[model samples]
Target: MLDQTRRGMAAFGLALMSGLAPVSAMAEDRPVIAAAADLKFALTEIAAAFAAETGTKVDLAFGSTGNFATQIREGAPYQMYMAADESYVAWLAAAGLTRDEGTLYAQGRIVMMVPHGSRLAADGSLETLRAALAAGNISHFAIANPEHAPYGRRAMEALRHQGIWEALGPFLVLGENVSQAAQFATSGDAEGGIIAYSLALSEQVSRLGSYQLIPADWHAPLNQRMVLLKSAGPVAEAFYVYIGTPAAREIMKKYGFGLPGE
Candidate 1:
């Protein structure tokens, strides 16, 4: 559906370009922003910084990128969206749901993680996992639901690259989103799981398990993209800008996200 709501979007961008605050912040005190679950920790820190620096609150909802895209298509009231996979944003832009195709804010990586007491090792090469599986020592392996989660899709690709996807099905534990997948990966419920490197790097997750970075060539790059929806306002627009700032980029790097330029 053509987004008739996008008619005045140019004005918002122009105002931003002119170094002026958008004309209105809208009646909503907080703009709802949808983000991919891989950003759970990093984006939270950035949002906290955003509020402290600008004194404006932005509500964030994190989940699978594909699920959010479906909601956005059905007119969900998200003012901005940050997707784990850029293709989702591109699809929305083509449907006229976005102010534009948006920004490639970050690139994500995956890691295989095992809880503290697991028999499996967090091996990037996945040789340990292959050996453990062959020895019948594997119980459950976790990942996000590939049907709707970008991290899960990448995990599938990586597993396939190693010639294990078909055999691992019976032991697979799928989470609805990558963050939950991370939770499952480290919660002692499974042997180990492939999950977002950003989540694996966080203090909360690192304390629970050990992780090793999967080779980037194993799957497609997680080219994250962010976009403003038709209903975006002053605060939402400002928050969008804040994401690309040096301060925000620094915070993202702290959590292992690859910045756009460096």
Candidate 2:
């Protein structure tokens, strides 16, 4: 009877083991976050860190704040929205799309980038660019589309402030968003372009090009903001809070973002 009971217990243990799902097999349902193009790298690093520490996952979709605002307004399924500017977050909040007024995450900066080995100086000043254009050496330049991208609008402001908006108009190659603008400049598709400083600091861009910081006074401040959408689940809410942690702030700082309230 003792041997029989032992066998039965062993069989039951095996059955239990067979029925249990492996932790690796069970995928965590990562919450979807719509983040600004400027955060393509910074937020990605932050999200990966959040997952490593908390064992929770997050899905990030990077794009223009204006495009994202429209999608959220039209009922896109994202649980969180991080904009390049606070105004978009406020717009969503006013539309009753967010849990509350969103929190400022960081301030972004712009830089002018040229592909590696370009004849034009990589100096942050626009003098080389103007000379190149006037000399007909540079045929194209890129910027995000000002209509729906905050960075693009800022680029426009910078160009206008420098009194070169109209002169450079014919050579402008507008990108869908800032990341693409960076790509264009890095790939030499456009001679060079103004893009987010965060991107300029990224490994990929760093490897392919050099950038000079566009003076903050050249354009409006890029006060980035993030909000938990009304449709956000627990995972999204938790990640939203995690974004405020020191770990996240450090990652942003590493990528050239100015910490909020700093």
Candidate 3:
């Protein structure tokens, strides 16, 4: 069962591009939970702990919130959804797809990250980014597509607040989601980018680059929210409740998510 859970978790993040096949027939007993890409590391740890504590498992698929919203509306069989923005959950509720409006899970932030040898300064003010752009030292700057990902949308807002949105346009390279944005920022193809603070905190991404948090006031609040779909069952409900537990909240904090109400 542990092996199966690992496999399911591993495949969930890829389900978007795979046409949702990875989660198609994952154990009927293990409910599928669609999550925002920023929650990948934190929620993965939380789920493992939940499984260990309860002897039951849930599958989690991480991707762009807007894309997940579209999938849920299209009847994707997801029992739960954790969106990086509360608006998406509210939208699902309005569509009568979710059990309720949903619970506020966490608040998120963005950061500017640059790889080891980049000309960019990884400054939260984005002034350095503007300077790099003017100097032609920035080849490509990574960001998730603002059309779908909440973090991406916030990134765009922050850049706009910094007054560099237009000039940076010609050098932009978008990732499908924030996690992918982090990858691109640290990869040699791009000099740097704004990505989820949670992703930048992860060891896997941080090892390759340095990051600085953007000001919270620069963008609208990233009030993350989660909901149980109408298709949710007992296991999924338990997992949803478990996310509010102290253990889970700690994991979220460790991954750079600001806990709700705290």
Candidate 4:
């Protein structure tokens, strides 16, 4: 009976110790990330894989880079910021909102997408776009709000470059963010959309549609940049470092993102 009593006491003590450990010390701590909307699909997969490998959790907030910048400037408590354009990250860095210098992570490309079985032309060039609009084959076209979304701005630039901006003006539908624009297209409310190539390659999208890559020169390069915030913890720093690993790079590539030179 005494031996059994001792064993019970030992088990109780172990349990107590386990329960007393600091929550922060029990697992790899996660950081709060403010990310651009175009990175939705890829970032979600990347974040999940990162947590599985390192036992860290990632709290992600997705929106337009401009909106994120405003939130960060207003003290949103983010430990890192990933912007669709380098300008926003640079601006935040210049304002001393970040720790280390900003790093260019990826270059995003634009694309035109339509529902999988839609009768729209597959070429998706400027001429085909105009022809489709004239034929009334497409009623509405969605785009991220150019006021905030870099992708939206690029889409506008592409339209203007093709000299069809005014002609398509009446049919343009604006979404609050790039992801929302994609939702508009995917839901069939809009016949098609201008969205990020990364999002275009997502399984959810693949099952619903086909996409055509827009010419690279249609607008300025969509240079994505990531910055470590001044309030970032050690774990956040480690996660940032992990983003540069070959494994992460491979994952990025699978989602249609290209590295600096590629």
Candidate 5:
């Protein structure tokens, strides 16, 4: 009986030690992620899920990819970068900021959104917008700054493709990033904004306004990519693998994003 008691006590002690172990001693760990602003909602949820499953935490910093790229070049301590466009990731790879081959994580679609109480029709096509502009109903339109945001560049491309760049040029209100552009639309600072469908599907925006998807063909595809930095730890690699799993892909789809392989 005494031997049995001793064995039980030893087992309990081992279990306690395991439970009390520091997170740094774990086989895989969490990584600091620098992500594009448009991915705020989706990536947060995904990060939480990844943490629950793998005991990995994702410390995320959300901003424009261009700015993040500049920071990374300046030696920001991020282990991974998720950009809203492939070009940004490619540029980082060229600059030796990350691994040469980055994974294409998701694709984004653009939309036009209006404020909660606005009576504006949900017509997002160029012709519809032209008519609204002619009527002087859309006083301010928000877009991300094209200098640093791929979505903004796409918005500009769409306007130019429709031959309305000069006509709509006067009403353009620029946000620092796509998420800010959505905020501009939601806060009524701008009557409408061209933003990512991902942001449009977010709970805050969905409750604050409605969106009409811009035609996919109007601009180049927004293929977002994620690259693991050379400085990435095992946790970062594990998280990267987690994102490509079926579970994460489902989460992305729920948030109005499409996976690359899909």
Candidate 6:
């Protein structure tokens, strides 16, 4: 009798494996979101909380906003785009690529960062940076590529505002994006760099160096925005709206972003 029972169970298992038996439905799909490099830390945390609440997953790809915008225009298969600048969303909207005008999510800030123990004083002022550069103590000052990275543009603006853009030209090391610029600063590849305040507050970056916030008036506002692409699915749409919720805003705030309307 036991041998017969074993044979019966084996037959049932074989039938299931061979697709001869009814099976449960496949799991729901996760939407892909293309986001700016400056959103790396904050969005990751927000996505996790979103997943925990909704039981849906969101896959994020972080890079320079301009690159992502170009890729979106080229049909990169991303369901949504979150940019460090609102202009990118407006451009996408004008191209008829987005479902709507999009939403402003957060405002970001930039900072000057140097590896811990560097000669540059952490005085939280550009004059300190100017003095270090004049002393020849900073061999390379890194920043995101201003051509495609908003942070880099702001970095350049700040330097120009401080009257150091011309002098720092010879010592600049440009990264592909803000995150890479932070990496350059942390790795000591560049003696100092301008990067997102959010990244500077991240534990990974905080351990490697210290930063001083750049005056907001030095550059254009970093009004971050997000949009659902024309091809966005239900998950993407839900997540897009979720970002405006209080929970999501709080997480962004924790990461150093100024919540919209605050």
Top candidate by TM-score = 1
Among all windows of ten consecutive residues in candidate 3, which has the lowest summed lDDT? Answer: 1-10
In terms of lDDT, which candidate is stronger, 4 or 5?
5
Lowest lDDT 10-mer window, candidate 2? Answer: 7-16
| Model 2, runs deviating above 4 Å | 1-28
For residues 36-94, what per-residue lDDT tens digits would candidate 6 score against the true structure?
99888888888877777766678989899999999999988899999999999999999
The pairs that clash in candidate 2 are: none
Candidate 2 lDDT over 1-262, as tens digits, reads: 0011111111101000112122321343677899999898888888788777766678899888999999999999999999998999999999999999989889999988888767677756688887887798876777888889999999889888888788888777777778877777777555788999998898877777788998899889998999999988877877888888888888899999998677
lDDT at 56, model 6: 69
Per-candidate TM equals 0.90, 0.87, 0.89, 0.86, 0.86, 0.88
Whole-model lDDT values for every prediction = 0.86, 0.80, 0.83, 0.76, 0.77, 0.80
Q: Candidate 4's residue-wise lDDT over 1-262, tens digit each?
A: 0011111111101000111112242444567889988888777777777776665667888889999998989998889888998999988888888986688889999888876555564455767778887787766777888888899999999988899777777777777778777776655655777888988887766666788898989899999999999888866676677677777777889988888766
State in Å the error of residue 125, model 6. 2.2
lDDT of candidate 3 vs native? 0.83
Tell me the lDDT of model 2 at 105. Answer: 87
lDDT of 1 by residue, 14-93 (tens): 00011324333354579989999989888888888887776677898999999999999999999999999999999999
What residue runs in model 3 are displaced by over 4 Å at the alpha carbon?
1-28
User: Top lDDT: which candidate number?
Assistant: 1
Clashes found in each candidate (C-alpha, N, C closer than 3 A): 0, 0, 0, 0, 0, 0
Runs off by more than 4 Å, candidate 5? 1-30
RMSD (Cα, Å) for all candidates, in order, is 9.7, 16.7, 8.8, 15.4, 15.5, 15.7
Q: What value does the lDDT take at residue 157 in candidate 1? A: 96
Q: CA lDDT of 176 in candidate 4? A: 76
